[model samples]
Target: MTEPAGETPIFERIGGAATVDRLVDRFYDRMDSLPEASGIRAMHAPDLGPVREVLKRYLGEWLGGPPLYSAERGHPRLRQRHLHIPIGAAERDAWLLCMQGALEETVADPQLRAGIYDAMARLADWMRNIPEDGRDQAAP
Candidate 1:
């Protein structure tokens, strides 16, 4: 939260929106190619354009940059937004794996990376929506 004087925000340390976009792009690209991500990848729309943009904005706001996502989408009810998806343990782990790989590739600051990873883990857990049957039939 509070950085020493002259220190940058974590958002800036991670290279801000452009860097975040590249990270998200690489993340989706990995999801498309990795066999481990096949199940979760199938849940995404074929076109990743919109998803990429949404993620960029969301990360920008989340990382202490401009409130781009909230400005456009209002409060980010992340749980509500993801409730329709079947995010069981497997799906959650796969998603975190992709994001971790991408963050390692993009963010150089160790502290920033750890902070982001911790937050992502919490958010991913909060997004879980799968029933005991592991089926995703809830409406978004």
Candidate 2:
């Protein structure tokens, strides 16, 4: 069937809720094991189950799938929500690393993957609350 008018939403292009869930699963799994992500990982609870579900909803809606996150959590004041987390340059980069890896594994379109990565990288940086030290370095 011909796609409806306007841009094909990223949500549909990425295969909707099920695909978003898989991406979140991969993201968290990488977070669980990546050394570069250890600092960020420590910020989570011993079990990642709760967070994973929450993120699935958030990402599902964020990528144009459905309004799952807002229906549950209200506006995504991401920076305010993460204010308690000690996000700095390192934490931001670590999060991005997992997200990039997840996107690569899940999204076949290279351009779409790169676009999502870029958006995520920007969002990750915005979550940082700590003042940038001169040494704030990019994620390896």
Candidate 3:
């Protein structure tokens, strides 16, 4: 079905959960390799397996596919979950950069890409937990 303005659902426009999964995979892969992401990357466990799965499930529900993440993990409480992480400006930007790169590589539709990117930017900014003075250094 079409939206009121004749726009397609974001899920269908971006090929649904499969596409979101691919985008998350590519995003983590980029993060795993990029030196700029080392700080945030180090916050994760040594293995990326869980991270990959969690993001896939989260995005699946987030992108209007299925409620995989919320069904299992309950409310995202994204800010609460990220409170332990030292999410300064650099980390936030780095995360957004990796995600942007992945979105660019995985999505072919311009409208879908723009919508996803905008939402992601807002979420990433909201996830920031570090104080402006940057004193917090504890791990996530």
All candidates: CA RMSD (Å): 4.1, 5.0, 4.5
Candidate 1's C-alpha runs over 4 A off are 1-7, 131-140
> What is the TM-score of candidate 2?
0.89
Between candidates 1 and 2, name the one with more favorable TM-score.
Answer: 2
- Candidate 3: residue 43 Cα off by (Å): 0.9
Q: Which 10-residue window of candidate 2 scores lowest in summed lDDT?
A: 131-140
lDDT of 1 at 128: 74
- For 15-131, candidate 3 gives per-residue lDDT tens digits of 888898899999999999999888879889999989899999888777766778999999998788878676878889999989999999999988778878888888887777775
Give the per-residue Cα lDDT of candidate 3 at 78.
78
Single out the weakest 10-residue window by summed lDDT for candidate 3. Answer: 1-10
Score residue 134 of candidate 1 by CA lDDT: 53
* Candidate 2 ranges beyond 4 A from true positions: 1-5, 133-140
| TM-score for all models, in order of appearance | 0.86, 0.89, 0.86
Q: Candidate 2 or 3, higher TM-score? A: 2
Q: For residues 5-92, could you state the per-residue lDDT of candidate 2 as single tens digits?
A: 6978788897888788889999999999999998989999999999999999988887877788899999988787887788887888
Per-residue lDDT of candidate 1, residues 1-140 (tens digit): 34467777677877888898888998999899889999999999999899989988988878778889999999998888877777888998999999999999898888788888888998887677775565543443
